[model samples]
Target: MPRRYLFYVEQNYCYGILRPIQNVLRSRGDEVAWLPVGDAFDRGGFEAGERVFDHVREAIAWSPCAVMVPGNFVPGFIPGIKVMVTHGLISEKRRKKDGVIYSFIERGLFDLYITHGPNTTTRWRQMADEAGYFEVAECGWPKLDPLFDGSLRRNASAGPVIYFASTFSPRLAAAPRLFDTVARLVAERDWQWRIQFHPKMPAAVTDRYRALSGDRLRVVDGHDTLQLLLDADVMLCDTSSIISEFALLQKPVVTYRNLSPRPYMIDVREPSAVGPALARALQRPPEVMRAVAEHARETHPWTDGRSSERVIEATDRLVESGLGHLRPKPRNRIRHWKMRRALRYYRLFPTR
Candidate 1:
């Protein structure tokens, strides 16, 4: 019995995070389609055979077995189970001011929360025990499956490639403050430099960085950060979950003004410290490799690249047990109104 799964991608950059699992589901002879929310259809480069829905209402009419999303917002009134796959691994940062790290679990929006590791799973279990709203699965991140499977490797002859990635949050992003410093370092250093910004990053900010691109300095605006991650020997980031993902490669990461209370990577508060950090990361990698490896383990333990398989099995079990149909359908008029307003604002829904 073939089942249909819907992947709701609200951002273009999320394609990398969901693509691997989508492929896995399809390979197992399941029907998979994509629901590009808002401008995702314009920005997300979805391929052929990947059925794309023009409207959320239309997708809701189809009522697939389950719908998966990387973001927080999902319509609770939908017929199928709503799964939260997570867009990134940065769970340390609190979305609220009250210091609640796992608030997403309390929202009662998702039927299943696919966590990346034991650490995250433990937290979700505690939350589930309290709310009893969703089920938790400790599946490793599917995006990193290729890296762990040895299918993706960097060419040593390319010299040291330093990848600079940042979050879109104004308070957390290092791009606004470190652009000039990075440009100078790229111009002076012998290594190749690649800068990739969050898809939601302002156009003005990206344009400023684009002006600094040259023969050795590459500015990437596309959704393909996986290639940059695979090619880079060292990564420079700030408060972004990409730091944790990059650390899984066992390479050195230099973070600037990380918001996480406990530091995971080489912390550099000032722009001047970035050059020294990069030098140390490249020249003496073993000194920092230990901490990176430890952090990687804590972040995600499954390095065998079977995370997608685990996710597929979990989905099948939920569907087979008919647990997917038990998800709560709360009637919150205010919430529905807010969602409709947001959809209209993003031009995702037709106006009355």
Candidate 2:
């Protein structure tokens, strides 16, 4: 019998993160479905033939064997081995009402942590020891698999393409700060420009970029950012995780006052210096290229496009071991209440 699985897309970026894994699942003759969790996500991100549930009842009745999440939380009432694949591999901090939280922090919502690389694997392994209920495996990120698989690449552009993406956080966003500089650079250089902002980016900022779009330049607001990264010769970003993703492609990235400028990145504090920094990155100097290689090795050493397969393997191994040995997860009353309220599932007991 074909096993069933669910891809829990809490955010639009989750589409990119989980699609590769979904491919592996379907290839193995396993069934997969989607449960999108928020209104913030764009429905256009879904492609035809991809099965999506309209509500929590649809998911519950299907009773998938596993649920892969790219975001932090999942409804425990959903039947599955809750797998946390995480949203991004960046070391950025997210500020919450309580305090600053890193991605590794446990939210008592998952049974497995599919880590991207050695750095994340090590941290998640340590966390697993304390958590007791979850297991951690260092299966490289599935999201980057398409970049390796040659299935996602676009045709080479007529001109050198520069891809620009920015975070939405006011304190860290460069879109607002470098808008004029980017506009000027676009005018000065004949190079093609592709700009994409974080989904949370203000409409005002996006409107400004949209107004500037033309034949050679575009403000990409869809879910095909991986395609944009492949098309670009160099990436221009703020402190967004796209910087890390682009660098992993063994390309150069120029940032505006990056919070932690890696050697692989050409960082500039002043918007005026943006042009020169971009010029340097475009040159692909030996040092910058070497640093980009090193950064990729440290973060995600798998460029072979087999991470999705490995994720499947890891899940199979965990299932073989069974869940009886693991400790029980906490009740998490308030969190479960919120999920039930939003997803509207209030069954007294989990069916699976």
Return the top candidate by lDDT: 2
Number of residue pairs clashing in candidate 2, backbone atoms closer than 3 angstroms, sequence gap of 3 or more or interchain: 0
Give the top-scoring candidate (TM-score).
Answer: 2
Q: What are the lDDT scores of the predictions, listed in order?
A: 0.77, 0.85
Those runs of model 2 whose alpha carbons end farther than 4 Å from true positions after fitting are: 94-101, 349-352
Q: Candidate 2 — what's its lDDT?
A: 0.85
Kindly list the per-residue Cα lDDT of model 2 for residues 183-287, writing each as its tens digit: 897788888999888878999999998988986789887766788888899999888777888889889999888887889999999999999988888899999
Q: Residue 132: error of model 2 in Å? A: 1.6
Clashes of 1: 0
Candidate 1 per-residue C-alpha lDDT over 126-176 given as tens digits, one digit per residue, 9 for 90 to 100 = 877765657889899888888888877765645689999988888888999
Indicate the residue-level lDDT of 240 in model 2.
73
Model 2: which ten-residue window has the lowest total lDDT? 92-101
Task: Report how far off residue 163 is in candidate 1 (Å).
Answer: 0.4
